[model samples]
Every structure is written in structure tokens, then in C-alpha cells.
Target: MKRFLSLALCASMLVASASAVSAKTYKMKIHSTGNERNQSTPPLRQFAKTVEEKTNGDVKVTIHFNGVLGGDRQATEGMQLGTIECGITTTSTLGTFDPRFNVFDLPFLFKDYETAYKAMDGELGDMLEKACLDQGLRILAWGVNGFRSISNSRKPIDVPADLGGLKIRCMENQLHVSTFKALGANPTPMSFSELYTALSQGTVDGQDNPPILTFSAKFYEVQKYYSLTRHVFSVAPLVMSENFFQRLPKEYQDVVLAAGKQYEADVRAATENLEAETIAELEKTSMKVNSINDENHKLFVEATAPIYEEAEKLVGKDIVDVARSCLNN
Candidate 1:
């Protein structure tokens, strides 16, 4: 019995030593279109720093900001094909890969940040993440671009009726296109990478995004009116190449996954602070900023409620029903 125990301990030590010797450096590249200093850099910097510290430099994450890797869809496809290791892309872009992601493009699914977090971190996020994995992309963690609001070069949107006949640049996703069309706006589908040039060149008169993104992207320079329509809560997910993730040593996998979750929280906190700061800063700029009151919000809701039913056709009826239950419950 003593000899048997001694042999088992020797085997364990040998395996541990082998594992330590086998640890190899992995270079992971994560890309996004956010501003390097303002929007995209912080969480990625935190992630890279934490991962390297935890693994003692066994893994290094290279973050490419401002679409240097590619536009949202291109970067996502790069990761899916394993040419890149990871990407942080908007939910609208995810919808192009799988229609189920259209759920996030639904108008006014969440009323506040607290409710949005509850739904995303819970069952709704699970459902969407499963769809992503099934489609051959592994979601590391869900993040956000803050609540989207309307901005126009023409006029302030105090009500839904103000959107009529306006040409707006929206994501190329069908759901967003249909949502804007339903509200009587002429929605022009365009990539976010081209948004600034398009606005500057008069290709589109208006767009919508969080205040932070509006300021960071300098949309306020081209847009004269910033209306707090707060129409849709945008979702951005940190995703990794499933093949790359599965190929990692188990220890590295744990470290990488934990870093994704940690920096998700970090980015969320940073977004909250930046949203307020950007609003104040935009007020200082030559931009007219306005907010939607309860009556206007209700009007926007009434005009767009049919989108929920239309979304059922895009993703499925059952998941949309489940989403409604989760949000209400």
C-alpha cells in the first residue's frame, strides 16, 4: 500500500511538471471599430494586462482598434475563419451571421441600464450566446454600446412624427432597416466604418447611437441635432474563435475566459461614466442636445410595437416570447 501511494504521488508530480514545461505563448488578436483612447482601448487594455499577469506572460492579446483589422463584419468573419482570434462587434453585425441576434435590434426592449443588464446577464444572453456558438462563433462575454438615440443634421426629434421623410444611416441589418422604415424614416443601410465620411459628404442626413459614441466618433461635428430618442439598447459581444479557444491548454482557457468576464464589467462601468461626460462635453460643442419626455417615449413605443411580432419571423416566435417573459418577469 505504501509503494502504491508513492507511485501515485510521483505520477502526479510528473504530470504537473510536464504541464508547466508545455505552456506555450499564444498571441491573440481582438479587433473593434471603437475609438482607441475612448471606447475600445480601456477594456482591452485591462484584459490584456490581466491575462498576461495571470499567466505570467504565457499569453498576449493584441487589440486592434478603429477597424484596423477590418470593419465589423469583416473582423467577425476573420475570427470565424480563424485568421484572427477574437473580435468585439455590435449585435447588429451578429444578426447578419445569425438572425436571432436581431432581438437586440428590437426597439426599446430595455427601458433602463439595470433592466438591460438583468436580461443580458441572464437567460436572454444565454439564448443569444448559444445561437452564436451554434453558428461557429464562441461568445466570451456580452457588452454594450449604450442606449441608441437619434441625431440629425436637419432638426431635433422631440417626437416620433419628426422622423418622417428623413434619410437616416442605419446598420445593414434588416431588423434595424425595417424598424426605421416602419417609423417613416428612409433608412439607408451602411457600415459604421463609412458613417463619418457618409455624413460629412451628405450621403445620409442622420444616425443614432449612444452619446459617448456620438462624441467619440465626432458625429456631433457633422450632426447639428442630438435627440435623446433612446430608441434601442445596442449590444456588443466579445467573441473568440471557437477553434482557437478549444485549442488552448485548460489553464489558459480558464484565464482567458475569466479575463473576458472581468473586463466586461470594467467596460460597463466605464461606459456609464463616459455617457455622462460625453453629454456634458457635447453640450459644450456647437450641438443642440435634447431629451425625450414620457409622452414622446410612449409615442415612440406605440409606433414601433409591431416590431416585436415582426422579429418573431426573423429569429423565431418561441425565443421572442421567452424574451418577453424574461423582461417582464
Candidate 2:
């Protein structure tokens, strides 16, 4: 009887050990190139908080901001290699991994935030998410870095004509280069990490980004003119490494997706609010800010009309048509 009791106690202890091991906690490291103050950070931070709270501390997430973990491109590569678990990056750079994403970078595609959100949340978003999965990244939600605006150290760019002879810095996307080439400016594709220094040191004459980045990143101090070109709305996706995501419990996976989708509105609102306030503050500064009316805007569009054709060739006509369908409806 004593021997049987001892064996039973030993088995019970082993079972308890196994149970404790099975209940082990998970930790996630999320990365982004955006600064701590960048509009993109808050939504992700909110997601982390929601995930931690709902999971009862079963999961813990740490965020690396301000390119400390390398820029968006590097972080994405790290995610693919399992060196990192999560990342939020502009979809423009993602085309380097999946060509189909190039369609999203088409200039003048989205008229406003409403139009952009509608298209992204619809079938177009579904298509892009599938493509991301094929590239080994599972998209959690579609987010934003806002529309791009031109800021140059030279004259005000009220029209494409003003861009002549100016060496404009663009994202490392070929289509952006083609668009700028068509407009008569010299387009230089450089990594975002090097942009500010390039501008300050006069390596590039001007660059384009949202108003918030121009103000927050202190590009206004380096560049003299800010134009309301509103050329393209850069879409950012919160993505998890496919391998890492597959290893997650089903309940935790659902929490991640739910938290990601729910917090998108909060990010968008903060970004929009920042734009107006940023523009107001920038107006008080020495930078000369300008916006084109209907005519000049039309001129800018007409100049870049060939971009649609190039986009059709890059991602195929069908994908472009699908995106247009969403925009139209």
C-alpha cells in the first residue's frame, strides 16, 4: 500500500509539471521605423495593451520604435527569418517582396481618407492580404502613414513645371521613379532612413511625405517649401511572421486579428487630427506652404497619366481594374 501511494504521488507531480509547462507565457516583439511620436505607434501600442489585458498576461509585447531595429525593410526581412515576430511598414516597400502590392502605390489613386479606407477594407484588401501570406507575412490589419506631400528646398511646387531640374528624393519604388521622370524632375530613390540627412546635407533637393512627418521629423527645418500635392496615400500593414503566427494558439491568433482590426480607426483619427494641427503649426514657421487649386491639380494629374499604364504593366491590368472598381464604388 505504501509503495502504491508513493508511485501515485510521483505520477501526480509529473502531471503537474507538464501542466505548468503547457501554461507557459508568450512574448512578442513588434517593430516599426516610425518614431515614438509617429501616428502609427499609438494604434499598435493599443493593440499590445488589448492583447495583454484580454489574455490575462499570458502574452507580453515589446515595441521597438524609431528605426532602432533597422528601417521597415530590414525589420520585414528579420520577420521573414524569424528574428522578429511582428512589424508595421508602409506597403510601398512591400512591393519588393510581392510585386502585386505595387498597385497600391499608384499616384492620385485615393481622393481622401474615406475613399482610401473603403478600397482597403473591401476586396482589394483581401487580395493584397492573400499576396502577403504567399510572401510569408500574415497581415493583421491595414493602417496608414497618410498621403504624401512635396517638400523641397527650392521654389514652391504649385505645378509640375516647378519640379524641373530639381533632384527629388523618392521611396525605393521604381513606379515612383517613373512618375517623377514623367513629370520632368530628377527622381532619386533612397531609403527613408537616409532621407533627412540627404536633405540637410543637400544630397537631394527635396522629398515628399505627409505633413505630420515633415513637421515631426523636422524636415521643415531642412526644406523651405511644402506643397499639398497629396500624390499618394501610403498604406501600412501590421504583419506577423507567418511561422510565428502559425505557432500561436488559436485563441491568441483571434485576439491578435481582432485587436488589430479594431484599433485601425483610432490610428486613422489620430493621423487625420495630426495633419490639420501640423499644417497649422507649420504655417506659423518659416516654411512656405502652398496648395494647388482645381486647375493646377488637374495639371499635375495629366502629367502623371502615364503612371496608370506603367502600373497596369507592373501588376497587370486586372489588378488595377479591381482597385479602380473599389474606388469607383
Candidate 3:
């Protein structure tokens, strides 16, 4: 009887210890260039939630939005150095490391979000992930920020000629600069954090961003007109340090990747749903919302054609060709 009681006590103790071990906690930080409510919010928050749930509260991901860590470039470099664990930033921001990322900047590259998603979730997405891995970063997933639109105080941009002599804020990417220059605007590449003040202070006459971003940043408050240029389809990548990722246990790595996939779905749904409502809300504030017709779109497209020729040299003609093929298919 004594032997049996001792064995039972040992088994109970082992069960308790195993439960305690399984409850172990891990923490990580993720940073982004936009504020918490921006389109990237869904994915960043969902990713954190999924990681915690998948690990049974063993892993915790804390998100820092709105350039809390730094600008996109700084955050990306920090990821590369393992100073920051994760970040979701524009492909334009990552272009400095891998010029191929500028392929996202190809004007009118994606006809719609469905086509873009197919490319990103399929072969091209895989290629981008491998490219990031080769450059010492791990791209877990891709998220969309929707199509970019033009907003400015100068005038309603009905045609490319209206952009002439207007100073516009653009992401710090050569493709962006070239596109604006081709359209006759003086493109000034600035960090996101500085955009509002630049708009208010008249340092810049206008800028372009997705509706959620323009709404969240309250850019409508300073600017008077919003044009649905839908010029470039924006993509944000969720990336981690390759070195740190490689150090994690295999199971943990799988957990993170799964969390990323879940986040992607959440972000896409949230962004698409919010776009129309955001535009309506902005219009209520008395900002003129103009939808450019197909005729005017031709002018915009003609203006940006040079951007493709210039970008092909930077990211290779093959990459441009592949992306263009996605447009047809």
C-alpha cells in the first residue's frame, strides 16, 4: 500500500510540473510605420493574438505602430541587425536592400486587389519570401494596404497636367519619384511621420496614400481634394530577422508562420471593408472626393509610362515582364 501511494504522488507531481512547463512565456516586439488604426492594424494585432493562442500564452508579441520604433528604413535595418524582432513595412521601404521590391511600384501593375492577392499569395509571393531570406530577413507573409489615391490642396487632379508644379509627398523610393516627375509633380520623398505637418504647414501641397491611411492620419483635414487615382497598389510585408528566426525552436517557427497566415486574412478583409466607409467619412468633412473617369485615367497612365522603363533597369526587365504578365492573366 505504501509503495502504491508513493507512486501515485510521483505521478501527480510530474503532471503538475508538465503543466507549469507548458505555460512558459515568450515575448517579442513588432513595429510598423503607420498608426495603430491603419490598414496594417488588423494583421499586426491578429498576429499577436494568434501567436499567443497557438503557443497557449507561451509567446507574446507586442506591437509598436506609427513609427514608434523609427521610420520604415530604420525599422528594417533594425530587423536585419536583430535589434527588432518583427515589422510590417512598405516594399518601397525595403527596396534599398533588394531593388526587386520596387516591382510593386510598377504603375497600374495590378488591375485589382484579387489579381494582386493571387500574385502575392502564389508564385511571386514565394519568390519575394526567398529573396528576403537571401537578404538576411524572413518574410512570413504579405499584407495589402489597398490602392493608393491622390490627395492635394492645389486643385482637383482630373488629369496629369493638373499635377504640374505641385509639390507632392511620396515614399522614399526612386520609382515613386520617377512616377511623380513623369506626371509633372515635384515629388518630395518624406517619412510618414512628417507627412501631416508637411501638409498643414504647406511644406507639401499634397500626397497619396490608401484611403484607410489618409483617413486615419486625418490628411483630409489639411487637404481639400481627394482623387481616386488608384495609381499604385500598395503591399506591406511582415518580416522577422532571419538570424533570430533560425535560432527559434522548429515548433515556435511554425507557430509564427501560421500566425502570419492568419493575420494576412484578417488584414485583407478589414482593409477592403473599411475603404468605402472611409471615403464616405472623409467626404462628410467637406473634402472634395473626385472619381477619375477612364478618359482621365488614360492621361495618368500615359504620364507614368516612363516610370516603368526606368524601373525595369533597376529591378531587371525579367521581373517587370513577369509582373506585367500577371496583369494579362
TM-scores, one per candidate: 0.90, 0.94, 0.89
Report model 2's TM-score to 2 decimal places: 0.94
lDDT of 1 at 224: 96
Cα lDDT of model 2 by residue, 1-329, tens digit = 99999999999999999989667788888988787788877788899999989877878889988778887889999889888988887787788888889987887888789988998888788889889988889888888878899999989988889999999999778888988888799999987779999999999999988998889988988999999999888888888899888888888889988998876787888888989999999998999999889899888888987888888889888889987775465
Clashing residue pairs in candidate 2, if any?
A: none
| Candidate 2 whole-model C-alpha lDDT, 0 to 1 | 0.86
How far residue 80's Cα lies from its native spot in candidate 2, in Å, is 1.7
Q: Write the per-residue lDDT of candidate 3 for residues 1-329, one digit (tens) a residue.
A: 99999999999999999988776666678988766567677668878887878777777778887788988889989989988989887788778899998899988788788999988987777777888888789888788889999999978999999999999999888888889999999999997779999999999999999988898888988999999999999998888988878766678889999988888888888888889889899889869999999989988888787777787899988778778788786
Q: Tens-digit lDDT track for model 1 on 109-177?
A: 888888888988888888888898886788887787788998889999988789999999997777788
Worst 10 residues of 3 by lDDT: 34-43
- Could you arrange the candidates by TM-score from highest to lowest? 2, 1, 3
Question: Given candidate 2, what's the lDDT at residue 40?
Answer: 78
Residue 145 lDDT (model 3): 88
For model 3, name the residue pairs that clash: none
Q: Assess each prediction's global lDDT (C-alpha) against the native.
A: 0.85, 0.86, 0.86
